[model samples]
Target: MSDDDAERPLKRHKPQHEHQETNVTEIERSPDFWFDDGNIVLQAGPTQFRVAKSMLSRHSSVFRDMFSLPNPTSESTVEGCPVVVLAGDTNTDWKHLLAVMYPAICYDLTKPNIMTVISVLRLSKKYDLPAFRKESIRRLRGDLPSKLEDFRKLPVAGWLYLGEVSDVQLSRTIALAKELCLWSILPAAFYGLIESIFNHDGSYRPVGLSLADEISLLKGYARLTRLNTEAPNRAWLEAESPCVPCDDCLFRTLCRSRCASLRSTLQAQQAGPGAVFSGWDENWSDEFCGPCIKAAKEAYNDKQLEIWKQLPSFFGLPDWEELRKMDLDAGE
Candidate 1:
């Protein structure tokens, strides 16, 4: 950069210039990423992280290209290190990704913190760090898979393997997916979200949920409920081609009785096709007659797969393959 620009004063929410570095009382040094010998400063809003240039350039092609240039804006410095202003990336995300990269030789990416994984994902995508991005996507899809068989492996109510997978968390994931175009996780995320919506005591909206998402959730819920009430998915209810249970079939009696009861009665059934047909209550199925059990399992396999297949559409999304094609992670 021109010496004129190099001498430019620090602007609002930026690190101080080298000549007046002591005036940086306004800037907060990142607790996680600051290093005494670090050669570059990354300004994430008012926070400054003193980190190595070569290290970042190694993982990030963007960083490589960036550091290759004489200097990119911020026109400020901490110590002798030139500060690069990060307009959109948050300090928390930068810290999270940098923490993984620095100080530690190896850290487990499996069962990663959902928020950390998400941050890494965002930063990785922005910075063109393919390894971190790929791993983040892997961790995300491990819990929320595109394939039905993989999703079935999670607990009946536990559609997502991430801790708790609360309504708030699901909404956050959906928001992230929308933000980053992470389409593959949407079908299962929407499926899990519908259960929470159904169980709410009238107030279904979570904070930060966009109007578009709120509408989609409600619409998807309605469609899913309609599907469950129809043949195939709800075939166990025996609305059509009613099954005359054999004398010893206790499940025949329980299933009929449960159908009339509140959703609170059968926790798994409350989720309808997604949970129930994953063979959640295999022992419960054992109570039915041979022919009845066979039919129910068939319905479970066929209808659950069908329900999974339609989950994306219920939320106004394209099919899984098409959704994959829409993602940044697609085709790799």
Candidate 2:
């Protein structure tokens, strides 16, 4: 075989819905190393060691955390040690630079560790450190349906970004990811969400829930008070459930959309009778607010049965043709 052909690895066949495999080992052991004066030193082979540190304090927290430590002593064991030796590559300076740089780029000190992991995931893939890469991938996949939206916004900076993935695979994996995680990725997430809702499942192509469905569910909950007289006061908004709860809330914009009336109410306090536009960008509503729902419903209505005429054909949902045939048979 040619050198190029020889270097090409065999493609592993994957089963549908099978989660991608990652290589990770439990952190049962650690590395023996020392950090001093913004530099890291580690023993390599006999008679030699490696060292690295951040070029700047703002560059990486990993280096800062490591540098604050003293060298490992003779009494120290691998357990509870925080350092990891990168396998294969032997340049200590480069390794030190990575230790310092990776953390700086991936982590925002103010955010939780989970958020930091999202940024480090691709970096893990780059170093080809099987354990780190595997663990990072698993963390992301395990968080799955919860991290779906977050996955969308994540820098597609690693092996996963390569075009080897299929539409079916991406759709299936993402359909099950976290909505908030998926929301972070925006257009990519939007397309993936759409694909997931329209995926085929062998003999029975399933119809998955769309963004519209989620909005409809929210609206249904909001309208519940009007339906049942004795139903406990089920206000959608409450002191417990404010307009925006978390920093990554999926419905923050939808729930707290700008109101003309609220603007007018505030304007009443101003000296001039002239009104200031609600200052709410219409795009926000078109993209994430309730108006999108209204617009989609209107468009769908305009398309009539033509759009849905194939819904049954594509997804086997109540098969309109089969239903008509059944009716004809009954008439006979």
Candidate 3:
């Protein structure tokens, strides 16, 4: 017999009771899953999903190769259908991935739940599904700030929301970013983790962060502290302005107060330098007239951009240009 044929078990004459027991077992189905005219049965852990092999193979090379394997007589079957047991992946993750592949279901790739996006990314990478992997990466990169201007505008609450996603835990996301070589996201992800570690009073509140993560945060925090202290000195607050008179003009005075206020706020909250630029409108009171406020805001925006340029350095990372080049070289 050929090697392929040798792999198959020979038909053996079985007793009536053995045959009956095999038939009964074959007829049994998992309650959680229903057959939908699907040709393949995929079992992950205790859960089983009846899905089409063609649909899966269309998107995943791994699945295509797996299904292409010659079936042996001794292989397990579910109701005479091929049973593909996937022990490595969780049921929830498999279901999430399948939801993205099937045309009958509407899965939003853009604003997918964080865990769903992570699941899709992980499975897609494993199964060599380039399209799904790209979509997942796009979704995750969407959450982060790509431009220097946007970094200052990132919402603090948004970071907390990301932390709340059960499967997309903050620590795990950091590790995954490193594994996937997503260098662009490291600064923001580290910032979010550092921000999450503090209470309103700036007390260190451990939220199940790993030791390595804690060390990285501490190192990043030290750098942020230096940046926050030096940020005001770099502000573009010119002494002379057309909007204010020479001697009695409160423009320079107000500008100084604003810078001091920003520094004080940073110190009080023990926040990263990004915090000084973000959410400022709500906290800023009009201590000066409109012209002065306008001028100050203009200068603040320029200073904020400057600070953003130094964000990677605050986390001991390479500058934007070098990081971008690295990402390009890696084909990311």
Error of 2 at 81 (Å): 14
The residue pairs that clash in candidate 1, if any, are: none
* Residue-pair clashes per candidate: 0, 16, 0
Could you list the CA RMSD of all candidates, in the order they appear? Answer: 6.1, 21.5, 7.3
* Candidate 3 TM-score, true structure as reference: 0.71
Best by lDDT: 1
Q: Cα miss at 201, model 3 (Å)?
A: 2.4
lDDT of 1 by residue, 6-115 (tens): 33312233445567763466778887788998998887767888989999889988778767866646656667777777765677888788877874656543445678
Candidate 1 deviant stretches above 4 angstroms: 1-19, 22-25, 71-75, 103-110, 156-161, 200-205, 230-233, 236-239, 242-278, 289-292
Local distance difference test scores for all models? 0.69, 0.32, 0.60
lDDT of 3 by residue, 157-274 (tens): 5531232443226667777666555677777777766666654445566656568766777787777656655554235333333322223346667656665665455455544533
lDDT, candidate 2, 123-219, per-residue tens? 3333333445444445444333222234334333222333233334343333332321222222232233333332222121333445554453233
In model 3, the clashing pairs are: none
